[model samples]
Target: MRKILNTAHIYMIIGVVSGLYSRELTKAEDFTGDTQLDVVHTHVLALGMLFFLIVLVLEKQFTLTSSALFGWFFWIYNIGLAVTVGMMTLHGTLTVLGHSSGEAIAMVAGLGHILLTAGLILLFVTLGKRLQPAPAPGSDAAPDPDPAAPLPAPAP
Candidate 1:
C-alpha cells in the first residue's frame, strides 16, 4: 500500500508540475485569463493531493489506537475526491463530444488529471483498509509463558 501511495504521489506531482509549466509557457506566448485560471487550479489541486499523500504515508507508518477512525476518515475523503473527479470527467466528456456547449478542450484535459486523482484515491483507500495493522507479536491475551517450559513450547 505504501508503495502504491508513493507511486501515486510521484505521478501526481509530475503531472501537476508539467501542467503548470505548460500552461505558463502557453501564457507567455499569449497571455489569457483562462490560462491563468488553469495554472491556479492545477497548483491548488496539487497541494491538496500532496496533503492527502502525506497523511496516507503517515498512517502507513504509525499505529494509532484509533487507526480505524483515521482509516474511515481517509476513506470518506477518497470517496469525496472520487465524486468530484467523476463529475469533472463527465462534464469534460460531454464538452468534448459536443453534447455540451460552453467548455474548452484545455478544461477537458484538466478533467483527465482529476480522473487520475480519483483513481489513485480509490486505490489507496482499498489498500489501506486491507493493510491495517496486525496485533503486535506476543501481545495477544494468551497465558503467560511458563518459565519451566523450554523454548519453542507447543501451541495451545
Candidate 2:
C-alpha cells in the first residue's frame, strides 16, 4: 500500500512538472507548436498519476500484497511505464527542440510496450486467481479468498 501511494505521488509530481515544462516550451524560441508537450502532460497524468491512483484503490480492495506475483507485477508495471514514458519524453523533447527522431527511438518504445504488456498480463493473472472462490471453509483444496470478501462456508 505504501508503495502504491508512493508510486502515485511520484506520477503526480511528474505530471505537474511536465505541465510546467509544457508551459515553458511555449515561450522558447524553438517552439514549433507541436503537441509534444501536450503529449508529455497527458502521458504523465494518464499513466503516471491516474494509473497508479487506480491501482492504489484496487490494492485496497484486492490486497495485491498477498499474491506472490505482487512484487513482480509492481516492478514490471512500473518499470514498463517509466520506460515507455521515458522514451516518449525523449522523442517528444527532441521533436520540440526541432531535432529529428529516428528508428532507434521507436525501437526503444517497442521494448517499453513489451514490458508494459508483460506487467499487465501478470496483473490479470493475479487478479483472476484472487477473485476465485475460497476453499469451502477449510476443505484444504484451496487457500483463502480476500479477507474483505470472504467466501461463506460450504452449504450446511
Q: Which is the leading candidate under TM-score?
A: 2
Candidate 2: minimum summed lDDT over ten consecutive residues — where? 137-146
User: To one decimal, what is the Cα RMSD in angstroms of model 2 from the true structure?
Assistant: 5.2
* Model 1 stretches with alpha carbons more than 4 Å out: 1-4, 7-48, 56-66, 101-156
**Per-model CA lDDT versus the true structure:** 0.51, 0.81
lDDT of 1 by residue, 126-154 (tens): 55765636656888656555545789878
For model 2, how does the per-residue alpha-carbon lDDT over 1-156 read when each residue is reduced to its tens digit?
Answer: 888888889888998898888778765845757755668778878877788788888788877779999789889988888888888888877777778889998898899889989998998888887775756865758564447686779997
Give per-model TM-scores: 0.37, 0.80
- Scored by lDDT, the top model is 2
How many steric overlaps does candidate 2 have? Answer: 0
True-structure lDDT of candidate 2: 0.81
